[model samples]
Target: MATFAPANVLDFGGAQLIYELASAIFPAVKKMKGDYSLGQVAKLYYSFIWITSPLMFWGAYLEIRRQSDSILTKCKEKKIFFVLFFLIFSPLCTFILLNFSFESKNVDDIRVYLSFHSRLGMPVWGGIVPTSASVMAAMTAFGIRYFCCVFD
Candidate 1:
């Protein structure tokens, strides 16, 4: 609802309804499993989301900017920020994920292992970054954009 919603407006009752639903539904969800603790869980979700969302967002974001660029050339502010964001933020976010990682205490919580399905299954430090769909999407989104940046 937050990302691609047609409009941002939400009535008080509707917002309250969503809040009520989320509050009720969240507590019923399981907290942690296996040797996986909250730290591990945090890493798992954080790793994928952190490493991936910006890249995916960039694809859409850049595409919009590029098309707009060709048609009108004056408002270059969004592109400047977009380029700066990709160049500066991606690596920074990548490093920040380390803070949330597990240190590999045992077989169940390898800090760097292959994540198959659930983040809890392989977890945050899971060696799934290269394999993640988000990573691929980012790579595809930023395709040639990186190299082009170097020349520019």
Candidate 2:
């Protein structure tokens, strides 16, 4: 098994990496604008997704392209493989599909989040719900990969 830690970090933690980038940049965004319309907020959020999705996909590609047996194959246990597969792919897939369908499926949530953003500025915990979500996505991705590698 490959023993390199950094490669795995990049391979699986893409979402968190993007989140950290966004977190670092968001203060500047907040400073540049006092408030945003629902549409503006949605556009900004979508734009971020569009920009970051490729990087995350690239990470997934790297993980799959590992020279050794794939994570699914390297696993000594079938149950563990399925579990890790679900944990890793589900969030990444959901994050992608949701972003693609976001405008249609999440109109109400966006409006509400926009209202909160207007009233209170960025959320104290994270810049926005999307940021929090991406963080969750990153955590899930990292957790699943770490388990798969360690337990395999």
Candidate 3:
């Protein structure tokens, strides 16, 4: 049987790896911006999204599976709280996804967006939200699993 400690450690390590991968990709993305046409940019964006989706889903699945029993027990104990929390957070997750999709545009527009990330005149929230959302999702999953393990 797999140990929980190793699983938890791997989860965190995977998250950090993903973070570093994203950071590395940002520079390449910035370079590619304005070089490609609209259709090309759209293709690239969707390609990245498609590639990452399976990985993210697998990570989430692993997290949930790790704490399945505990989460079930917790839901049994605090069903209402779980439901309410899910209700409130679901919209936030949706908003994040919408923002991610909305940001995907023509290469020219993409260049402007990339320029914003270069520590220049950028809207604070613009640069922060995407990165923050990713970190938050990973952290949230880790936290919930930890909490479930501790409580149950």
Candidate 2 C-alpha lDDT tens digits along 69-141: 5544555456565555557665775566434332323326754454323423323312343443454455455
The TM-scores, one per candidate, come to 0.27, 0.33, 0.38
* Highest TM-score scorer: 3
What Cα-based lDDT does every candidate model obtain?
A: 0.39, 0.43, 0.44
TM-score of 1: 0.27
Tens-digit lDDT string for candidate 3 (1-152): 11112222313555445434543654333333333223232223333443364466557657666766776677668756554443346446735643444344443574445433322322332334344445345545544554544445
Q: Of models 2 and 3, which has the larger TM-score?
A: 3
Ordered by TM-score, highest first, the candidates read 3, 2, 1
lDDT at position 26, candidate 1: 33
Winner on TM-score (1 vs 3): 3
Question: Which stretches in model 1 have alpha-carbon errors above 4 Å?
Answer: 1-77, 103-152
RMSD of each: 14.1, 14.0, 13.5
Q: Which stretches of candidate 2 lie over 4 Å from their true place?
A: 1-38, 63-74, 83-96, 99-111, 114-152
